[model samples]
Target chain A: MFSKILVANRGEIAVRIMRACRELGVATVAVYSEADRGALHVQVADEAVFIGPAPALESYLNMERLVEAAHHTGAEAIHPGYGFLAENPEFVRLCEEAGLVFIGPDSKAMALVGDKIRARQVVEEVGVPIIPGMKKSFPNLEDYRQAAQEIGYPVMIKASAGGGGKGMRIVYQEEDLLPALEAGQREAKAAFGDEAVYLEKYLEEPRHVEFQVLADHEGNIVHLFERECSIQRRHQKIVEETPSLALDDDLRFRMGEAAKKVMQAVGYTNAGTVEFLLDKDKNFYFLEVNARLQVEHPVTELTTGIDLVHQQIRIAAGQRLSFSQEEINQRGHALECRIYAEDPAKNFLPSSGRIIYLREPVGPGIRHDGGVYAGFEVPIYYDPILAKLITWGETRDQACARMKKALEDYVILGIKTTIPFLREVVQHPAFLEGKISTHFIPRYFSEWRPRPPSPEGQRLALIGAALREMKQGRERKRPTQLMSAGQDFLSPWQTLGPWRLGRRS
Target chain B: MNFEFMVDQKRIPVAIEKTSQGWEIDLGEAKVVVDAHWISENCVSLILEGKSYTLHVVPVDNGYLCYVQGELWSLGRPTQDLEYSQADQAGAVGDKLKVKAPMPGKVIKINVQEGEAVRENQTLAVVEAMKMENEIKAAQAGRVKKILVSVGELVDADRPLIELEEE
Candidate 1:
C-alpha cells in the first residue's frame, strides 16, 4: 500500500477521494487553485498545494504542474478524481513516464474507449446493439444530411471528443441542421477543443441506463448492474439511481453481459462505466464508455457494497481481482442528487456568491459529499456543482422518499440553487415511476411556472412585516420615549394581543 | 397585534402578543408559542413550535430587507397615497444614451457598437458567469445609443449596458 497519494482535482470529488484514502490508511495531498484556497477539500486534506490561478486552464487542467507537484511531494501515485485530468490519456502517459502510478485505467484503454465513435464501433463488434448512426465523422453539410436521412428525422449530432452533454444537439429537420451543427461544433471546440462530431438516431423518451464495470490489471472484470440516469436537464444528469426500474432480470443480465463484453474487447482495467440508451420498447443500445470514475459512482457503491475508488487504487497498485463476478451481490436501492449552484428558474444558469449559511441533511441513509462551507466564495471559474446528496434504503421507493426529505432538509443561502427544482423533480409522477429521459426537464417543465404563495403564507408574511415595523419603530424611539409608549394600551403589541386572550383561556 | 400577511399569493390574518414565558401567536387555525431574541438591529432569532428560524430585517429605501433561514427575501410595504403632478412638456428630442451593465460579470464578447441598429432578440453582448456564457439581447428594436462595457469588464447584475434611441 502507498503511504501517500496526490489528488489532482478539486471540490466534492477531491474530498470524496481523500475520505477513501483516509479509511485505507493513506495520506492525501490536495491541489487547489487560488479561488479554492479556503475550500472544504483543501482544508480537509493532509497536505495542500497551490496549483495556479482560478481559471482551470492554468490550474486544475495543467498536467505538467500537477505532475511536478506530485514529484516534489514524493507522492507515489496521483488520483485524478473524475473530472479535469481524470481521463486525459496523455496525462496518464506522463504519470507513467514519471514512474508514478496513475490511479485509473492505462493510457491505451482510455484512448480507445474515450473516443465516442470508436467506442461505439468496438461495442457493436462485440454484438452489443448500438444507436443507429454514422461510424465515421461526416465531412460536410451534405454528408450530414444524407446520414440524418438514412437514420430518419430527429437525429442527434454529438461531439466525438467528450461527453457530459456538451456539443450535443437534436435536429428535427434539414433546415435546423446547419445551425445546430455549427452551434454543436462551436460548443465542442470551446469545451473539448476538438470540433469532430458524428450523427446518431435520436431516440425519443429513451431512458439513460449505464452499467458500472470493474476490472483488475490481470484482465478479470465484472459488472455492478445498472444505474438509471435519465433525470437530466440540458443533457446533463441531475439525479441518478441504482437497479433501474426500467430493467428486468433478463434485460439487466443482457445489458450487463454486453457491457462486460465491451470492456473485455478493450482489455479494460480498473473502474469504468458503459452507458446505454434504453427505449420504451425495452431495446437497449450502447451510448458510450466513460473510461474513468464517474460523477454518479456513489449510487453503484451503495448498492453493490464496493468501494470503487479503493478498487481503482488497488488495481493501479497491481492488485488482482478481490471478488469474482458471481460473488458480488447487490443490496438495496440507492439514489444520488447533484446539488449545483445554478438557478433552475432561469434555465439553470450558474450562480455564484459567498455561502452565507449551509445546513446539510443528516439521518439514517443520508450522505452528503460537499465541497463548500459557510464563508467560502463560490468561484465562477469552474463547474458549479456544490455537493452530491446520496441516500440508500431497503427499497427504491424508500430511497426516493428519503432523498426527497433530505433535499428539503438541505439548504444553502446567498446564492441561487437547483434545490427547489430538484425537490419538484423527485416528487414528479414520471420520476416516481422511473419514466424519465434526457428531455425530462424540457418536456415537463418548460412551460410550468412556479405558483405564488398561498393566503395563510400571506398572513405569516404580514406578521413578519409587522414584526419588522415594530422592531424599526422601537429602534427610532429613545429609551424614555419607548418606556412612555409602553405604558399606553394602544401600543402595537397591547392592542390586539394574543397573549391576553391566552391568559383568559 | 393582528396583522395581515401574504404567503405565496394568499392573504391571511394573524395575531400575536407577549406572554410571561415568551409570546403567543394565533392564526385562527392554530396557536403556537414563540421565543424571540433580537440578534441585531436588523436581525432576530426566533424559536416557534420547536423549530428555529433566524430572520434578518433591514430597512430598504422602499421596502424591508427580510432575511429568513439565511436567504435575503424581499418584503414590499403597501404604497401610501400621495398627490401626483403631471408634466406638460412634450416633443423633447432624445440624445445619445449610455448603457450600463445589469449584472456584474466579465464581458465575453461585444456583438454591436455605437450607432448600430439592432432588432429585438439580437445579441448585443455575452457575459460569462460561473463558467457559462449568457448572451445579452436587445429588449426592443432601436438604434444604438452607446455601449459602456467592453470585453473582459466585470459588471454587476441589472447595471445598464447600452443606451438606445427609437429608430
Candidate 2:
C-alpha cells in the first residue's frame, strides 16, 4: 500500500477521496488554487500545497503544477477525482512519466474510450449494442443534416468530445439541424475545446441507465449492477437511483455482463461507468463511458456496502481483486440528489455567493457528501455542485420517502438551490411509478416555478422574521460589538491570516 | 406589534404577540401559533401549527432575506407608499431603466453605444463568467441612454451596465 497520495481535484470528491485514504492509514496531499486556499478539501487533507490562481487553466487543470505538487509533497500516487483533470489522458500520462501511480485507467485505455466515437467502435466490435449513428465525425452542418436524414428525423447532434450535456442537441426536423449542429459545435469548442461532432438517432423518452465496472491490473473485472439516472435538466443528471424500476433481473444480468465485456475489451483497470440508454421495449444501447469515479458513486456504495474509492486505490496499487462477482449484491435501494448552487427557474444558471448558513440532513439512511459549509464562498470558477444527498432503504418506496424527508431537512441560504425542484421531482406521481425518461424534466416541468410558500410556511417565516428583529434589538443593546453578520462574508483565510495545519483526529 | 412586510414583492399585514409557549401571529384570513428558537444569528428553529421547520434569515438593506421550506423570501417593512423594488418597477423594461450584470464577470464587449436603438432580446453586452459568455440582452425596444461599462472591465455581480430609454 502507498504511504501517501496527492488528490488532483477539489470540492467534495477531493475531500471524499482523502477520507478514504485516511481510513486506509495513508496520508493525503491536497493542491488548491488561490481561491480555494481555505476550502473544505484543503482543510480536510493531511497536507496542502498552493497550485496556482483561481482560473482552472492555471491551477487544477494544469498537469505540470499537479505533478510538481505531488513531487514536492512526496506523494507516491496521485488520485484524480471525478472532474478537473480526472479524465484527461494527458494528465495520466504525465503522472506516469513522473513515476507516480495514477489511480485510474492507463492512458492507452483512456485514449481508446475517452472519445465518444472511438468507444462506440470498440464496444461495437465486442458485440455490445450501441446507438445507430455515424461512426465518424461530420465535417460540416450539411454533412450532419444528410446523416440525420439517413438516420431519420428526430436525431441528436452531439459533440464528440462532450460530456455533461454541454454540447448536445436534439432536433426533430431537418431544417433545425443546421442551427442545432452549429450550437452543439460552438458549445463543444467552448466547453471542451473540441469542435468535432457526430449524429445519432434520438430515442424518444429513453431512460439513462449505467453500470459501474471495476477492474484490477491483473485483468480481473466485475460490474456493480446499475443506476437509473433519467432525472435530468439541460442534459445533466440531477437525480439517480439503484435497481431501476425499468430493469428486471434478466435485463440487469445481461447489462452487467455487457458492461464487463466493454471493460475487458479495452484491458481497462480502476473504476469506470458504462452508460446506456434504455428504450421502452427494454432494449439498451451504449451511451458512453465515464473514465473516473462518478459523483453518484455513493448510491452504489450504500446499496452494496462497498467503498469504491478504497477499491480504486487498491487496484491502482497493483493489488488483485479482493471480491468476486458473486460477492457483490444489491442489498437495498439507494437514491441520490445532486445539490447545486443554481436557480431551477432561471434555466439553472450558476449562482455564486457566500453560504450564509448550511444544515446538512442527518439520520438513519441519510448520507451527505458536501463540499462547502457555512461561510464558504461558492466561487464562479468551477462546477456549481455543492453536495450530493443520498439515502438508502430496504425498499424503493422507503428510499424515496427518506429522500423527500432528507430534502426537507437540508437547508442552505445566500444562494438559490435545486432542492425544491428535486423534491418536487421525487414526489411527483410519475416518479413514484418509475415512468420517468430523460425528457422527464422538460416534459413535466417545462413551466415549473418555485411554488410559493404555503400559508403555514408564511406563518413560520413571520415568526422567524420576528425572532430576527428581537435578536438584532438585543444585540444593539449589548456593550460588545462582536458577531456582525458581515463577518460571514469574509473568507476565514483572509480574517485568520494563513491557516495552521496539523493532522486532524 | 403590528408590522407589514413584502413577501415575494406582495405586501402582507402581520400581527405578532408573545405567548407562553410561542408567539401568536395573525394573518388576515387566519391565525397561528409559532414556536421559534434562535439557533444562530440568522437561523431559527421553528414549530408552527405542530409542524417542525427551520428558517435562515439574512439582513438586507431594507429587509430580511428569509428562507422557509426551500423558498427564499425577501421580507421587509412596507414603504410608506409601497414603492416597488427595481425589479418590480423594471418589469418589461419600458421607458427608462439600467441594464445590470446579473452575475459578475469581465465585460467582453458592448454592442450598442449611448444613442443606439435596440430591440428586445438584442445582445447589448457580453460578460464572461465561469468560462461561459452570457449575452446581456435588451428587455424592451429602446435607445441606449448611457453605457456604464467598457469592454475588458471586470464588473461585480448585479452591477448596472447600460441605461436605456424605450424607443
Instruction: Count clashes in each candidate, considering only residues at least 3 apart in sequence or on different chains.
Output: 34, 0
List of chain A TM-scores, every candidate: 0.89, 0.93
User: Tens-digit lDDT track for model 2 on A348-435?
Assistant: 6677888776777889999988888777888877778899999999999999999999998787877778998899999999998888
Model 1 segments more than 4 A misplaced: A138-150, A458-505, B1-18, B24-105
Q: Relative to the true structure, how large is the alpha-carbon lDDT of every model?
A: 0.77, 0.84
CAPRI verdict (incorrect, acceptable, medium, high) for model 2: acceptable
* Prediction 1 TM-score vs. true: 0.83
Considering the true interface contacts (CA pairs under 8 Å between chains A and B), give the fraction that model 1 also has.
Answer: 0.21
Which consecutive 10 residues in model 2 chain B have the weakest lDDT in total? B87-96
- What lDDT score is found at residue A473 in candidate 2? 79
